[model samples]
Target: MRLLHLGNVMMDLVLTVPALPERGGDVVATGSRSAPGGGFNVMAAAARQGLPVTYAGAHGSGPFGDRARAALREEGIDVLLAPRPERDTGFVVCLVDAEGERTFVTSPGAEATLRPTDLAQLRPEREDLVYLSGYGLLYEANRAALTAWVPQLDPAVTLIVDPGPLVRDIPADALQLLMARADWWSCNAREAALHTKIDDPAAAAGALRSRLKRGSALVRTGPDGCLLHHDGTLDVIPGFAVRPVDLNGAGDAHTGVFMAALAHGLAPAAAARRANAAAAMAVTVAGPATAPGADALDAFLRQSRPAPR
Candidate 1:
């Protein structure tokens, strides 16, 4: 099965700073780098693992858009849409703190301008693994189009939704409808807490699953690995421990890798274990989306023992 990533290509300016600046204050970056980020990270993570991925979002014409498109080409990901001239490609200023945590300020660009017609060309197919980002679904320019098209997807398609950090910002009706149709849901601990209002990851997963008629809940809990809930049981998938230098796209990396594994018939618990290993490898590098390739990832897993049954 092929993975179809529905989102925008973005340029992430990752900066390592001792501390984030407050109002009327400034903190110089200790280190900085520009790379592919945002939803692009997710697609790259999957593609790096040799997953066939098609980007179903709009690319734009500008410095940011040019590089974004070029990066995808470099990663062997297919661009399924034409570039938009009206809006530029999106960019993010990601401030990674000493603890490897990141804060982002983003500008939604061409990614947000995806009209309903743009999605029509890439209709959902049976056995297709579709990735949907809440960041894109909530944008005003994309919301109506996405909402109108969500129910049209084939029931056989596996739709995974990651609400990102703005889970609370999406309208209740829209969020509910998407969750009902989504076959799987993945998000970080903070995002899970925000939407479910449950502090415990297991509880949060349970609450999140209550909305979906068919799907499992996967919550990435940083070094603690991820919590996977399916059929009323929660399993904690342990991850590797490495002192991270940057944590810009950790969740995206996990989502991509996990999707790749799932598309290949791996169970949720097993897929999450591999994803955890992939994400841990990503944070060890300066780039957020620098997950290991298929061979490298397999090697990493071989070095580690199998997830406990």
Candidate 2:
């Protein structure tokens, strides 16, 4: 199965600090590295699952963009990038504290410059699943482009929407429209709460499931695992235990594996389980796109104890 991931490709500079410093105080970074971010990480996770995946995004003519492309290629993802001559590649500076919590400062950079016309250049064949992230919709240009293209999708093609950190400010009407068009909606607990104004994660997932025309709603609850609501049923999948060195890209890894499992024809519950396992493995590493290989992931799944009833 082929999956197409549409969103930003960023150069992530991750710094592991001993702890979060006080306001205006200095903190020494223990370690630092650069890796892929956003949709790039998702595509990497999917590719690591041995799926045929392609990434669509904007890249600049710079070293960072070159590094991003190389990183995707290393994961076996086909890169379909629109070139931005004037701007540099997008980047995120992530600061991870001792507890694995993170803070991010991002510049949309070249990704923000992508236009609707750029999407028209590529053709998504039938049976290709499309995966989109909320970060793409955070900007007006990409939002308008995605909004225009979503309605034109063929019913046979599945579309998965991951409302990452940026969906809170999206206009309600626009959010509703995108949800209506999506075949699957995935969000973390915080994002679901912010978007639906429902404090409880389960209730927020239910609200999202109810509001969408069709498709399942998945609420990712960090270490608690994920809650899925679809077709008047709810399934809760427990997370696997792992020593997390950095939690920055764990959610993106989960979303990516979820899409890959769906493309591989797994049921929603089974897909969530696979995704949770992948996420558990992701947090054990440090880089933003540090997903496990197929062999490692399979071993991890094999050894994982089942979730308690």
Candidate number of the best lDDT: 1
lDDT digits (tens) for residues 231-299 of candidate 1 = 889888887867786565677888999999988899888899999999888887866678889899999
lDDT of 2 by residue, 73-170 (tens): 78778877656878788899988888778898998788776677878876778778898888888878888888888888888888898887678777
The TM-score, computed over Cα atoms with residue i paired to residue i, of candidate 1 is 0.93
Per-model TM-score, in order, reads 0.93, 0.92
Model 2: pairs clashing at backbone N, Cα or C within 3 Å: none
- lDDT of candidate 2? 0.84
At residue 118, give the lDDT of candidate 1. Answer: 87
Error of 1 at 148 (Å): 1.0
lDDT of 2 at 308: 58
Predicted structure 1: clash tally: 0
What are the Cα lDDT values of the candidates?
Answer: 0.85, 0.84
What candidate 2 gets wrong by more than 4 Å, as runs, is 18-28, 98-101
